[model samples]
Target: MSDAVRKIIHIDMDAFYASVEQRDDPSLRGRPVVVAWRGARSVVCAASYEARKFGVRSAMPAVRAERLCPDAVFVPPDFVRYKAVSRQVREIFLRHTDLVEPLSLDEAYLDATAPKIESPSATATAQAIRAQIREETRLTASAGVAPNKFIAKIASDWNKPDGLFVVKPAQVEAFLTPLPVGKIPGVGKVMQGKLQALGIATVGDLRAHPLEELQARFGSFGAALYRRARGIDERPVQPDQPVQQISAEDTFERDLPLGEFDDAIRRLAEKTWLSTRKTERVGRTVVLKLKTAQFRILTRSHTPETPPASLQEFTEIALALRERVDLPPSTRYRLVGVGLGNFRERDEVVEQAGVFGE
Candidate 1:
């Protein structure tokens, strides 16, 4: 609404895991590589550009990736090392501005409207940060600089691998109009299909729809879509944001019988609990996801007034979710996932201590 422009930059590391593997091992240089174990259960964590030529992609099964590229090299993932490298890259970002939000280990958003320099231009900050990442971490990062997060995130991917793109404030609408609605964040497969069914094919088409009509059809998310279509996102870049969710999942080599599903759920719950050590916040909901042998997915979730305080409590909540699923006994499962959600601010909880004490 305010015509003021905010400089935002998005940076994504190039084939992060695979590149790190190659950077550490000269023997793997310039080769088609998939960072994952060779098994039906394992998914590709990252694929080198060479592997992408063969259609290998992250989250794709390693077996399928191998089928796509017979000579593709499979490497086990080392998330510990990846996280360490990510910290180093983040330190590089901190040197530029404090308004840094990490999307994942290899990607982040930076607000450079007020940089610690004589000139606080977004493009200059992006270039300097990228140069620093390459010089310090030996990794190349593609960067997109724009007036807002919506444009910056898309611009970052415009140039793949080691590239830099910028979308000036004046160019926002022209840049967004021709792009498909599917390109907007949160518009996934089902949402895109819905938009297509309504003759809203492009961002321009979405812009043409009455905001009230969109709200009538899709609720609050439709309002977000309207903003994205207009290249208007007002979310500020956040620094050191607290964790919102914790989850753990496992893909089975073969469809496991319902008899063994309980064990898998227990393991995942334990893993999820272990992963929560980094977060001070507690979750008020538990969710269980199951993917059948046919890949038909089902999710069951529950939210309690109080969060689970221990691993045993969390496991029990997960078991309750398992009881809610009424799949056929003969139906086998390919994956099982456990998650906790609906986090509350730790500080808010701390502040409520006196009230609860009363």
Candidate 2:
């Protein structure tokens, strides 16, 4: 909101998951690689730049990616090792500024307007972080430095793998006007279609529309779109914000029978627990999600005062939720998912409970 500009930097790892695989395996270096098991039901976690050249990408089914890149080497995902590397990278970031907000394991925003060290500018801070990642992790990171989060985030992707781009306060409009609407965050396939239908296909096009008209179409999100299109984002770099929940879900390739539900829920609960453990947080609720063969979704949740802290307790809650479902034996389902919620720091649980009379 102020005319005085701030220095924000977004650092994104270069094809992070696939890069990890290539970094570890001598044979995978400089090769087209896909990180996924070979199966029709399997989804790609990441694809190397070489693999991406053949139109492979994350979340695309491995079966389709294989058809796209016939010679691509498939490697199983090892999230455990990936997280380890991510932690190392985080430490590197902390050495510069505590205003680091991790978007995921692979990307983060750093507010270095006034960093711990007297860096001349945000660009220098970004260069240091990128260089540290390369030296310590043997991987590359792309960085964008700008006056705000929205501009910086978009600039980070402009140059591609292992590149850096900058967006100065004076040049924000020039950098954003020619970009497509989809390049703005939150403008996915459906939103893009909506904008396209309104004859607003580019950032400049959106800017031409009246704020009132945009608001009528998109509610509060319209205002956000207007700001982002103009390369303005006031969101703070929230590194200290506590995580509220952790969840994992799956969309089944085909509907599964009720008899098969128990095993599926068990597996999902285990997966959720494993993921939550990585963040070192405990949850008070267990959630089970089900989707019918016809795409009807149902969710069941339980908040036990004493949340399950072990695999045995995890399985117990999941089985209990499964029993509550009234689907017939022949009824089929398309998806099953499990999750944990109402999380808090382990050390603060006692105080949290007392405040809530738990």
Off by over 4 Å in 2: 1-4, 246-340, 344-358
Residue-wise lDDT of candidate 2 within 1-358, one digit each (tens)? 3423678899999999899988889999989999876764556778999999999987677889999999999998776788899899999999999999887678888988888977888899899999999999999999999998888888899887899999899898988898999998778766788899999999999999887888998999999888887776778787966667777666665678866667566656666664565564568888888889887888888888766867668768867887778877787888788888888777777676777783
Query: Cα RMSD to native, each candidate?
Result: 7.2, 6.1
lDDT of 1 by residue, 42-124 (tens): 55678999999999998676779999999988887776788789889989998888889987788899988888765547888
In order of appearance, the predictions have TM-scores of 0.76, 0.76
lDDT for each of the candidates?
0.84, 0.83
